[model samples]
Target: MHSTMERWSGRVAVVTGASAGIGAAIAHELVKKGLKVVGLARRVEKVEELSSSLKSEKGKMYAVKCDVTKESHVTLAFKWVKENLGGVDILVNNAGVAIDSSLIDGSTEDLKKMLDLNILALSVCTKEALKSMKERGVDDGHIININSVAGHIPPQDYFCMYAATKHAITILTEGLRRELVARDSNIRVTSISPGLVKTDLPPKVVLQVSPYLNPEDIAGSVVYVLDTPPHVQIHELTILPVRQRL
Candidate 1:
């Protein structure tokens, strides 16, 4: 068994935005590794379908219909995890959104939505997960942020606000790390920056990049980070396709 699989087996993990895309991929991988995995998303139907499909895996999967933007919903979700799966030992903050809106022409609603999901919701989830872990005395917990390349460099015209949110994530991850260190906590935090992954892209666009990455690639990295020894921390990792210009 892999280091992570060995250490994390039989533990609980909560993954957000797990209806599809990167979140789904991460949830699926964790389920196969024998961790009781809870998938949180607003689209319960889609997550339900995924649950049934993954039922045969080594571990178990439960679907929690949640709206990350709402604090009430996020609170209910962590509560559900506690009531059902006990507590979380790992949190994959994988829920994110990227809509087409520029700084100059952006709708207030659109920008607000992006900020809520991309930043606020993520912070709420982290806070809740930490509470659960602490309640259970899980000092060796891990938190993985599914950040983007835009967090490092703002993309072209239409992605200014999105970039701003990602930049905040970079700081958030580092800030959280510092706090954890100051408290002398064993909980580890890591951030992954993936460039141009083929999530909702068309086959034509995906094929344009000779070595474009898939959701599975990122999922594999998540496992790698968690698999490390308790003392080792993979602070930040960046992955990109060979053909990606940016």
Candidate 2:
């Protein structure tokens, strides 16, 4: 194992949307590095299965059923982390959904759901994570937000609302970095904008795109940002497959 893998020995990490896809990949990577991981998702059974599959006893894994949009559930999940896993040193805000439809034809309810889950839930999770970091006196903690290339530039069409939420996340991560710096907190905030990751977005939207990147590729980028030195901050990173135009 590399030195970076050893660096995570005995640390605590909380990953939202960790039942499958990129979130699960990140949790797996963290465990490989010897960090205890708390997996939060709405699907209790799936998360439990993932947690149980981990091979290391030195690193623990816990699955917490949580609907990120609900403040009560999020609060409860974080509280459990504090009590059970010591305290969170790394928080990955990766729970998000996409509702793809032309703006004129998009259902208002779909847009609302996207905003609530993608933007609002991310904000709520970051807030709770910061509180835990402060309480633990854990200077030099990390916050990683999984943004998208759509956030950097507008999409062709039908992706307006989904892109909007990502744009908000990009802005949120930037603003959060400033706030932590002003408070003289050692918290590092980073946003990773991935281009066309191969996850189950709606089939209709997936059909419109070209080849996609793997979720683990995005996860690797995330680990890179998180493993950086305490004094350095990587504000924004964009990762895309070589053939990808966007």
Query: Any idea what lDDT model 2 has?
Result: 0.86
- Looking at candidate 1, the ten consecutive residues that score lowest on lDDT are 201-210
Residue-wise lDDT of candidate 1 within 1-246, one digit each (tens)? 336458899999899999998889999999999999899999978788988999889988899999999999999999999997788999999998887687787799999988999999999999999999889888999999999888998576687888888888999999999999998899999999998887763246545755668899999999989888898999999999776876
lDDT (C-alpha, whole model) for all candidates? 0.89, 0.86
Model 1 global lDDT (CA atoms, 0 to 1): 0.89
- Top candidate (lDDT): 1
Q: lDDT tens string, model 2, 54-129?
A: 8655677789999999999999999999888778888999999987777887789998999999999999999999
- TM per candidate comes to 0.95, 0.94
**What would the C-alpha RMSD of candidate 2 be, to one decimal place?**
2.0
